[model samples]
Target chain A: MIEEVAVALDVGGTGMKCALVGADGVVRHAERHPTDAGRGPAAVVETILSVAEGLAGKAYADGLTPTALGIVVPGVVDEARGVAVWSANVGFRDVPLRDLAAARLGLPTALGHDVRAGGLAEARLGAGRDTGHVLFVAIGTGIAAAHVVAGRAVTGAHGAAGELGHILVRPDGPVCGCGRPGCLEAVASASAVARRYAELTGTDTGTATTRRTGSASDDGSAAGPGRGRTMVTAAEVAARADAGEEVAAQVWRETVEALADGLATAQALFDVATIVLGGGLAQAGAGLFDPLRAALRDRLTFHREPRLVPAVLGDEAGCLGAALLALDQMETP
Target chain B: MIEEVAVALDVGGTGMKCALVGADGVVRHAERHPTDAGRGPAAVVETILSVAEGLAGKAYADGLTPTALGIVVPGVVDEARGVAVWSANVGFRDVPLRDLAAARLGLPTALGHDVRAGGLAEARLGAGRDTGHVLFVAIGTGIAAAHVVAGRAVTGAHGAAGELGHILVRPDGPVCGCGRPGCLEAVASASAVARRYAELTGTDTGTATTRRTGSASDDGSAAGPGRGRTMVTAAEVAARADAGEEVAAQVWRETVEALADGLATAQALFDVATIVLGGGLAQAGAGLFDPLRAALRDRLTFHREPRLVPAVLGDEAGCLGAALLALDQMETP
Candidate 1:
């Protein structure tokens, strides 16, 4: 008798990552590939199949046959139907990715939402490893979260659970992509922070990056104002604040304030034991954690102050989560 | 070898109801008495004790000595502490209802929020029976709800999980008792409906008890200013709609619209299998159900249409739910 491995694939907006995981949750082999999603769903599916096959080859070389496969993607996924009902980034609609993968790989397959899968990874093995109730929030391009209760991620009745981003904050602030106004996403998302800073400084800054402010200079400090106008992103704002930039300091304060407000509302509702912060903005480290914690403490009165910690497993979380789903499917059936 | 009965009491703003529930979930005896809450927490506690004794005495005469007691009251409660933290109606603040009852009745005791208890009863033996995820909403003089997941009510980390009424619906509409503007309670509650209609008509018709339309003589049908001015409570409003009152028809339409908006928000966030309607306003029967369904259908596009049903066990639900909590306490210790 031979023990078989499970292949986990995570497809994001930019790239695809795959890993071969054993029954004991060890990643025996891992690989990454560019998604090039602008070529559409067909190309993306092809890339997924190729990457999965590549991972399977590696596992076979290691003298193992993959028993099952798990794939996680962004957007509205109909997990029961094994279809990605709609996806904005990958240009997919009603694509039966599960059936395609199962047939191509000759293994049982499962599909899920990327953020939810990542949250599942965190709940099972990351920052919220021992927590019974956990909420994993990804604060990158836009804010989104997934709720994991008692080791199970609630997919919701209509498959739209843990959409903390759309929870309205100001009720009359900026309009959101979902056509809602003043959503938490509109205020606290990393993209929102960058947009707000760019709007304030009136500069078309390149990709936002962090830099130390160095001293308490009013106009500019270590990172001099390029073209008499210092343009900065969320990361830069946080870095400069740590280094003592007055303008960056103010922007950082506002960003933390908005983030706290949104997190407080989430606290009042879910009362999750731990809130694992992930995605781009969280990379700011204590620059993000410190003020965010202070803001939450200031806003919360009677609600539980959840332990806010950075997510473990990073970009590979979604892939691991998807693998877990596939493993569970094989065992249950 | 005989099972002992327990005294279950539901303390509302206006009255207190008692029932002797056997271990098998049967109500062996039932009684009601005025709460007279204005007399303060001391008086209310005394009333609850006296009523429990009466119910216990009846159970004893029937060869079943009560072994435990359960009491449910309105407002914020610290169940772990066995204290009624705050209840404006009963004027109780940090009052140890469970300890008081246990000492008085010489039995194990349980105390809980009134609406949450009702929700538990619904989940176990009423409309939400067999449903793992249920949201029990009580739209009465004030509005509140309880989320029942896996047949257990979620008390939240701060004991304020089911405060659905406090969710802001309108950003600048009417003011709510919680000092917020345009809360779900202020917009969709039964009291809000009557108050709104009264404000428009400026007639304190003293609890609109009947629904009436204009004479049917005009153009072979009821058509006039009074056709839409149904002089009735929500119950009478339903009756008038049944009897073809044009005025009551308008009022009923507004009620459904408001409720549907609120419920739609709940549906999007909770994604529960069923939403059980309870409390005083729920007495409208089909008046509430028919229009609410239509309104929900119109508003929802990607959400599950929750199965809406009337809460069974009526007012006794709270007591039974409290008993369930008591049973949990007994089993755990």
Candidate 2:
């Protein structure tokens, strides 16, 4: 008897993580491929299709029947319409990626926003499991959030919900890529931390220099893709902060405060039961969680304090979330 | 044949609006009573019970059958538990008001937060009717909001959702009632407008003075509530701004800017299809709507611009919303 599975993909600017996930969410097969976004969106789309087709073929050859396909990408996704509305990272502009995948794979396909998909996975299978209301915040190159209520993430009217990173936390703070000054992302993101640390250390090489040297592209920037840079990462800054470096500590402290403000704002708005921190910055572990918990608690007044935990699935969350989305479609349909 | 109806009451710190609403949402009868909060929480609870019972009695007398009772109050409410968790306005703390009403009236009773209930009514029956996603912001003494999705208002996990008033819009602006500096309520609420005008004019008598002499009491204590006073109301300030008063224009312009910032943040977060502005400041009509619409549009980037409109239900929204809640309970249960 052939086992039933879903083909899932988490497509980022620099790379894609694909998996053949069984009904129980176990990965039957996993693969990683460079997105080569520098080659343009057309090549990237073709690569995605071929990779998905290969995954399906692999499943069939391995005595597994692929029942559905799920794809998650960075950007605004009109999930209801099965369209990749816009993504700066993948260079998707009004692409009917879901329908294309469904037609190509001859399977039911679901497309979702990368952050939202990860949030769904976390809410259902990771740190926030069993928490009816979960807020998953990804703080990396750029900040984004997903509000999961009763196991379903809210997709705003324009499919632009959870833009927590853009909420203004500082009025006279740094300028965000969105052209606004003092956005939470501009002040608190991991990239922002590295940039601030570099600026304070007088090694200010600008975002372009960092991007050219960094390993990953952020969701906020619309710049061209390049090789991962070999430069100072947010992890190094965290290490320095932990080592009692005054400047690094100051930057980290500011990051925590701004993040607390943003989270407090979210708590005030969504009032979720749990807040799961994901992405790169959350990797700071205790260094990030300790102060963040305290700061968020201090800022709250009458609102119930939520359990703040680090995301457990790490990088696999997106792919798993994509699979979950596909599974949900099957169950609902 | 007897008409079916629900007894609805919108309880506030200063007064209560009670209504007998028919199945079609029409108000069969309406009445108002002073809350007499100075008499304390016990007395207020008694007043609420009396008012609800009176409405039910009135329904029976008028050849109508009261099927259920719905009451909306300010502050954190545990709707699932049918308790008013914490309401500073009505001095309710963990009061099982839902059970009390249900037991007394011998009918199913629903409890809700005032703003959330109002948002529900607006989304389902008022200005936001036909709009699937609606954000209803009430800019009164303090700014508060309700996020209504598909005709249901989101009551946060702790039932403390929609505290839009507390979102920070200005970092170095003013001290909010929540002890936070530069909250939206501190900068743009009706009380904030009056207080700002008072500060700019150097009259500085305080919110109590304005309310004691002004026509309305805002949620904030920055200005006093009473009949349009010598201290000048937010409405008077709008009139002055309309007549080209430089100081008033400057104050009004700042208020609009701050409100726009807050609304833009809300738009980015909720991405709702319609934003219904209610409360006293919204009573400014064109003076508030035109500039607020333009300012919100200017601040938005890629997010869809929501339709900004004045709330049509006026002060009756809370009562209507309460009725809607009861009606909803009847249908869902």
Candidate 3:
């Protein structure tokens, strides 16, 4: 018997990545394109449909038919209603992506938040596999998370269940994009780390600096987009620290402390078995993982200590997660 | 057809309550006794077994042999392991309550945390009826909560999922009984409310105040024994406040604010449809509910507001919930 196939797509603020994933979880064909999200939802939808169509054509040529299509996007999404209630990145309000994609591709389709899709992937086959309760936290351009309980992602009543970034860590610490003061995202996000570094040292090293007297400039050129003026990006800071930069080390220490603070709060609230860290910051490996683990341990006294690990599926996690949802729908239907 | 009856017992820090509950959701016979928990786990277990035996004997004499037994207690209870991992009030440490109850009663048994059991009752037939996700927060001698998803209470991997009272609200706040600073419980529990009132005022209510300030007496002498000179019972504070005492009013305001803060955080994290407040302090009716509602409303900015209501089943909820779990076990087996 031939296995089924689904075309999965993850639409982000910067770009969209699509994959023709088989029942065996292998991506047979893949492609990517800039979202140009500011172009409005319709144009973005067109791009999504065109790329999905291309992937479907490729699958057909490979002697496989796409049984369903799964697409994941950012912002507050109503999975049950198949409506995108709001999307800060894509200028979407109440866009029924599921029905639109189904109409466009003539197949069963599902819509989900990008973070939840990643959580589903981790819950089913990655770090959180088989865990009764798992939290998948993604930190990159911004911080967000998704929860899986009993092997299913919790979409909450309003489709805004996993807004970990908005969780108030500091009631009046820093201003966040959500117009909130002292949110976890405002302090612990990758962008926030870099921004803090720049604010501290009065140098724009693709980052922000804090109120610390230190400098870790491995290379002479600290002047770059978000870097070189003593304020280096979290990446630049990490690199400079790796190359024995003093200022970079200070910034790195603060970043880990902030991440641990946010994560400790998450652990206490959910008390889950595993926490899967994904997105760009996680790519730093030990630079991000080691200090974070130490900080979390120091903070937790009564709550169960959640095992922290990097997300396994890389960039394909969201797409594959969506595919898994579609697969469940197909099998049950 | 004759309805099956189950023997249910609720063990509290001060006393034990037992009932013979019918499958039709009605109590046929009820009784109570002092828990004497400080004597140790063995004595507590004996009291529990004797209570169950008495209830079962009454049911049998009434021409209905109890089908199962349900036991609900406090502290960190591991339901899957059938053990009461630890309970400061019960003097228990890893006591196999389920197995012991089953062995003593000669029937199948189920054990669970008292608050979670009450939450199960509320979710199934009370305030949260028909709600998909419900968080039942009980403010009493100690603070705790239970989450019900799809009419089933979620027991996390370590049975520590709903320790809401321990969530650190202030990093530099008051020291809690759990040895943590600024824990929700340390400031919100019935005892905490009274303790705070005492700390603020120089009068002592003659009772170890529980969270519910509504039951306190006007004069400290009438409250109870074993209370400190500067400590008024939470009940006494509520009583004075009811009579328009300014000091009592201030304490009440702060208590409600802290409860609202904790609830708002829980609302943001869990997004449950309803929150059922139970236990001792919940007995305040409008006094507690009205203020908490207003406070929660003031804090909520971006989350779906869950309906707040007093638990309908009152003290019998835990017994009924335990019965339901036992029945579930029987049916599944």
Candidate 4:
């Protein structure tokens, strides 16, 4: 009897993670490719199809039958209709990537939102495993979340549920990428933390008021390469905070505070069992979790404190999640 | 032919709405009774059991076969465990309500949260019907909400999901009943609206600062009967606002603004298809929906706007929802 596997691909702005995963969720084979999203969504769709077909061929070569296909992309996904509605990074505008891939590969397929898929992987195969109600939050350049009940992630009517990063945390804080001011991600995401540190340190020896002064550029050049070699990233800031640097400590504290506020609000609404924190910010380990846990506890009243833990899948989460989706698409378990 | 009916009861702080509903979701018979909660938890439990049994008997007398039982109470419910874990209003502490009802009536039973039950009714049979994903918000003396998808209400890890009232909207707003500051209920609940209106008018020609004044009595007496008949309820405020009362309009505007913030945050997280406004405040009808719809639209950037509608269930929603839960518990369904 031939072993069966799901051909899976997780497409991002810069690259794609491809894999053949067994029904048991173990990855049988894995590979990577550049997405070349700058070439436009049409080219990206072609790349995805060819890459998926190649994975299927590889599965056959490895003595396994490709049972189904699953693909996850960063966009507003219409999962029921198998359409990629829109994506800011990939420029996907109403692309029916699922049908196109299914036609090329001759298998049942599932399309999903990238962040939601990553959260699914985390909820089922990573930190949130065994936790029936899970809220998976990824704190990277831009924050995102997925609320998983049992083993399924809720894709809201418009497939835009779990926009945790954009949930308003501060009313008068900062403008977010979504044009909303004081969104949780505006002040607490990994990129936001690094940016805040840079902003404060640039006008050194002054209190961090989050206000602009004469030294800062008009169009925000300090956030760019114009700040020279003095600029530091979020990871470095965590290290500095851990080492007792006042500015870095302040920035880290502020990030933790904002994240706590966002998570508390999340708990009030979701009331999940576990909150699996992933992406770059979770890499800080105790530096992030300890303070965040404390702050979140302080903010909650009657809410059962969700178990806070770092995600275990790392970068492969989306690919594994795609595999899970594919396996779910098969008629047989 | 004997019709199958579900015996259901919705227990609140003040009253219990009991009914026997048919499989077609029509109530065969309905009645109301005082909860008499001051007699304590045990009495309340006895009252619920007797009321449920009476409803079942009433079904049989009406030539209908009672199939199952469902009891909804205002509190922390353990749906999976079939227990009423906690209730501030009814004074229940870990009562095995479902099992007790099942044992008493020799029928299948389900225990659910009151607001969640009402939301289930709204989502399946009321205003939210036909909408795939529904968020039912009840803004009366206090604000509460239920998130229902595909007919089932999401009972979080602690059976505490959909605490929309407690979600933080204002960082510097009034203190909530739960001791949290700036909760949505602190500023947007019906009681909050009425309180604000009174405070503004009492200190006439002054903006509502949410602060206590010398004339307001030191012991919070203004909220009690000691105000010499000056106290006005939320309905009065709404009527006044509609009739062009300046203070009422300002109070209503502020309430709408705060509610919009809360609902926008809810949309960002849940992204439901429709939002059904129920309970006391929803009685204002278009006076609330028209402005709230616009304000919520203004807050969204990438989010799909959820349909704003008034709940059609009125006060019977909870009883009907209880029937839904009971019907859902039946094996044949």
Candidate 5:
């Protein structure tokens, strides 16, 4: 008998992480494709459809029955309606991705927000697996989160839930990409850290050091991806802080403090048992975790301090989560 | 045939609102009793048990079958285990209220948190009735919230979810009863408005205006209730603001701004379709809603602004919620 698999795709701004995942969560096959968002959303959609068909065909050739298709994209996704409502990077506005994929592939399909999908995977299979309630914060160019409860991520009423990055932390802080002043993303996101560090060090954003591109990295801003396009990465700032550089240390402290404040607010609202940190900034590891943990503790009162841990699934969490989402939909239906 | 009903109790700091509600949500009978919390937790427990038993007896005497009992209390509740983990007003510490009520009344019992119960009722049957996702905020001496998704309140991992009031908003603001500085509760609660007004007017808290005694009102703080004893009531402050008093206007503006900030954060995270405002201050009607709605709209960017509405359930919401809880439990079981 052939094993059953889910055709999954975790679409980001610059690249798409595609995979064939078994029902047991094991990856049978995986591949990647450039999104080339500059070519526009229509081209991107076509590319996505083509990639999904190829993967489905690959599964058949490998003697595996493709049970379903799952696609996770950045931006506001109405998971219930199977629509990609709005995305800044992909230029999607009310695109019925689920139905399109389902029609094109002739399989049951699940569409989810990328961060939410990643968070679901993290909560169910990564660092938050032991906890029933998990908050997955991905600190890339723009920060975003997914609140996973009992293994299901909450997609807000408008399919825009878990916008942790936009929550106001500093009333007079910098303006966010969303045009809001003092948003958490503006103060603590990887891009924010790098921007602030550059502002202090007198470096330019257009021409500077390269930001690393992860296997499944996502830039949640509407403007698009920022890979290899920064004066300095958040990791370099962390390194500088560790090396006892004054400006870098100050920037790092400010970033950690803002993140702690944001996480503290999330804790008060969701009361999750664990918070998993992911994305480019999370690559700093202990350098980010130690200070973040202490700061989060100091801010909490009667609220239980959430366990702060790093996401262990690396970049493939989103693809795995896409698979999980498809499996979940099938089970529920 | 005897009509089946659920005996419900909404326990607050100063009073207990008791009721018998049918499965269709119609109230058959209702009454209130003074809590006299100064009598301590043990005596309070006994009183509660006696009251619930009496209600059950009354149901039988009135030709209605008492099917189950539901009780809502303030503070940290472990709903899964039916334990009133900790409550400042009720002085509860790990009291097995559900089991106690169950044993006494010989009926299945459900224990719930007060604000969450109110939120549940509001979402299912009141102002939030039209929406599937709602955040019910009770702004009394302190602020608290319940995130209701599809008529179910999120109890969180530790039964302590939806602590919106404790979220940090004004980091430079006053210290809260919970020993935290700049919490939304400290900056925007009814008591905060009254206290700020008093400070501006130089009125002493021990002897001035009286905060009204509300039915089914719970003070959600570990430091206990602060009602009737405040310097000036938030209602009076609202009146002053409406009368164009500069100091009162400033206080009201600050409160509105903080509340807007808090709600925006909630919207960014929960993306609910509606926000139901209840408790003492919401009684201000348009005075609070008009400006609050505008402020909230100003703060939102990509997120949809939740419909700001006053809770229509008034005092019986908690009791009704308790009844609903029992009914939900029975059905699930």
Candidate 6:
């Protein structure tokens, strides 16, 4: 008998992580492809469809049956309608990606937001596996969150839930990408931290140390070259903070404080059992979690203190989450 | 043939709204009683038990069968544990109210946070009845919220969910009851609005005008006399603002802005279909809803604009919600 598998793809602006995942969530086959979003949405759609077909063909060649397909994208996704409502990253606007994929591949398909998919993967098979209520926060170039309750991630009514990055943390702080001042993402995101550190140190080569240290697992968008050689990543700042550099410590502390405020606000609203910190900044391990946990504790008055832990699945979480969504559709349908 | 009903009670710091509700979500009977919390937790519990018992007795006397009992309280509630974990208003500390009520009433019991219960009611049978995702915000002496999705309120992992009041909207605003500076509750609640107006006008008699106007639908906690005769409640401030009071307009604008910020934060997270405003402040109706709707719209970008409306159930929402909870328990059990 052929082994059953699901085709899963985590589509990002720069690349796509494709995998054939078994019923038990183990990746049977994996591949990568450049998204080349600069080519526009139509080309990106064609690339996604062809890549999915390739994966399905590979599964057949390996004597595996492709049960379903799950595709996750970075944007507002109307999961119920299976439409990619909007995504600035990939230029998707009301694209019926799910129906298109299903029609092309002759399989049931599931579509989800990438961050939510990552959160689902974490809740079901990674750091939050044991918790019923988990909040997966991705802190990279941008900060977003997914609230998973009882193994299901909440897709807000308007497909716009989990925008944790926009919560106002500093009323008079820096302006955010969303055109708001003092947004949590503007102060605590990995990119924000790097920008703050560079601004404070007047050094553009700060990220050089991060690249030198070989900790380049950050989303590529946040790792681009700065104006000068002194540009540093948040990781470098974390290292400097650990090494007792005053300016870096101050920047790191502000990041921690802003993150704590944002997390505390999330806790107040979500009250989840655990908060799984993922994406680039969480790679700092103790550097990020220690102060964040402490500051969150200080901010909470009567709320149950949630366990804050690092995400375990790393970059694989989104693809795995896509697989889980496919698997869930199979079970439900 | 006997009619089946559930005994429901909405317990507050100062009063309790009690009702016997049928399965069709109609109240067969209703009554009110002073909580007299100054008598302490034990006496308050006794009052609760006796009132529940009396309601059950009334159902029997009226030829209706009381199948279950549901009670809602304020503050941290361990709904799963059937415990009122802590409530400053009622001075309850780990009171096993559900079990106690069950033992006395000889029926199945459900315990819930008052606001969550109210939200559940609003979602299932009140203002939000038509929407799958609803956020119920009660802006009284303190602001609190309950997010209801698919007709059930999210109780959070630790049973301390829906604390929307604590989300920081203004970082440098006044200190909140929770010892936090700039909490939404500290700036936008009815009491907060009243306090701000009084401070601006240097008059404590703000609520006096409200009393004179004879619109005392406000929670009694905010109706007490202020230091002088010219004081004003949030309602009075609204009235004054309408009558061209510049100071009142400024105070009201700040309240609206702060509230808008808080609600925008909530909308960003929950992405609910509708936001139902309850409690004393919402009594201003168009005065609150018009500006709040505009401000929320201005703050939101890619997120769907949620409908803002006044809660219909008024003070009865909690009791109605408790009844709904009891009826739901019966179905599940």
TM-score order of candidates, best first? 5, 2, 6, 4, 3, 1
* Greater-lDDT candidate between 3 and 5: 5
**Considering every candidate listed, which one attains the maximal TM-score?**
5
Model 2 chain B weakest lDDT span, ten residues long: B208-217
**Candidates in order, interface RMSD in Å:** 7.8, 4.1, 5.6, 5.1, 3.7, 5.6
Among these predictions, the greatest DockQ belongs to 5
Q: Determine which window of 10 residues in candidate 6 chain A has minimal summed lDDT.
A: A208-217
Q: Write the per-residue lDDT of candidate 5 for residues A291-319, one digit (tens) a residue.
A: 99999999887788889999988889899
TM-score of 3: 0.88
TM-score of chain A of 2: 0.93
Per-prediction DockQ comes to 0.18, 0.55, 0.33, 0.52, 0.58, 0.52
- Report RMSD (Å) for each prediction in the order shown: 9.5, 3.4, 5.5, 5.6, 3.5, 4.5
Which stretch of 10 consecutive residues in model 3 chain B shows the poorest summed lDDT?
B212-221
For every model shown, what is its TM-score relative to the native structure?
0.73, 0.94, 0.88, 0.92, 0.95, 0.94
DockQ for model 2 equals 0.55
Query: Roughly what TM-score does model 4 have, to 2 decimal places?
Result: 0.92
Checking candidate 1 for backbone clashes, the offending pairs are B208-B233, B227-B247, B228-B247, B229-B247
Cα lDDT tens digits for candidate 3, B1-333: 555798888787777777888776678888888888678878878888888888888887888879988888877778888998877666777899899888988999988877788888889878889988898887775678888888778777677677777766665667765555677776777777777777677654534333211111111122233554545667777778778999889888888878887887777677788899887787777888998999888766656688998888877788778777777777875
Report how far residue B184 has shifted in candidate 2, in Å. Answer: 0.5
Candidate 6 Cα deviation (angstroms), residue B144: 0.3
- How does each model score on lDDT? 0.71, 0.84, 0.75, 0.82, 0.86, 0.86
lDDT, candidate 2, B110-198, per-residue tens: 99988888888988899999999999988887778999998899998888888888887897888777777778887888877888888
Candidate 3 CA-lDDT value: 0.75
Candidate 2: residue B313 lDDT (0-100): 86
